[model samples]
Target: MKTPNPARRSERSRRAILSAAFDLVAEAGYAKLTVEAIAARAGVGKQTIYRWWPSKGAVFVDAVLSLSEDDTGGLSLPDTGDLRADLSGVLRAIVDEYNDPRLDAMSRALTAESLADPTLNSEITARILGPLLEVTKDRLRSAQRAGQVAADADLSVAVELLYGPIYHRWMLRTHPLTHEYADTVVEFALRALEPAH
Candidate 1:
């Protein structure tokens, strides 16, 4: 029998740990998630998790990322030249993902846990929210280069405009998030971002 490659075995262990973390959070919530529990579920030693991550929050963020992987390997904002359509596509996808029972449960649990714990919040911001905002910033910068966005437009504000409404609606549960709403948000945001004559 061929000897197992160390790299492949490590990768398998890592994916297993991520899967276990996602499943645990989806079932028991992040508040109850512990390194020991993740190790037990992943069938690895606690030291293995500690060797790979400094904290459970890091593992949680990694799990969240792994769970959200797509054809491109992970979720990323699109840059299709049509700013409105690209933003709409991302927001619509977010809505669809949030509608999944397991994803919804884990996402909400993470939000709550982050709110209650500053360290977890920092980890999540660095790993999850930071990358997402960067993708939006990159897309806006591309649009600006193409003369599709105003030169003076604040990219940070633009990012907020694109994602804030969807997040607000999702968090408050005040209304259903639909593809139509995503498109509407894009139209409204693009109107504000359009270059002046």
Candidate 2:
């Protein structure tokens, strides 16, 4: 029987700590979550967590990234040549996930933390949100190539238009995030992007 390498064991411990941190936040909210709690839940020592993550905020961000991977299944957007349908499908899926209890908890916690700390805000945006937005832009660019969207359509603006409203609704709790809302967003966005007569 060969002994496990120390480096591999350390890496596994780190992953476990991050996963446990996310689960704790999802269940108990970030305010009640602590490094000691995560260490115990992860079956690792408290020093181990402190050695890697500088603060609970860093651990929370890592956990959020992990949860996002589970949610998005790795960020390749759906592009079936029909711009409106593709955008609608993607956005609706996002809305559904955003409304889920686990995701909502994590999102709210992160939002609160971001509001308090500019560094955390920048880290989350750069690590989690930016890549997702880039994926959206890539899909819209594909639509442009297929002529479903006008050549001059601003992909960045289009992506923002598609996702901004959904985020607004989620953050504000203004209305139910339904497929119907997604459909309306797609319709208005597509019309706006259509070539001028």
Report the number of the highest-TM-score candidate: 1
lDDT (CA) per prediction: 0.86, 0.82
How displaced is residue 116 in candidate 2, in Å? 1.2
Candidate 1, residues 81-169, lDDT tens digits: the string is 88777888788888887787777777788888889999999987877777888888899999999999999999999999988988999
What local lDDT does model 1 show for residue 119? 97
**Deviation of model 1 at 177, angstroms:** 0.5
Measured on C-alpha atoms, candidate 1 has an lDDT of 0.86
Badly placed stretches (over 4 Å) of model 1 are: 68-73
Number of the top candidate by lDDT? 1
Residue 97 of candidate 1: its Cα lDDT? 78
Runs with alpha carbons beyond 4 Å of true place in candidate 2: 68-75
TM-score, each model?
0.93, 0.85
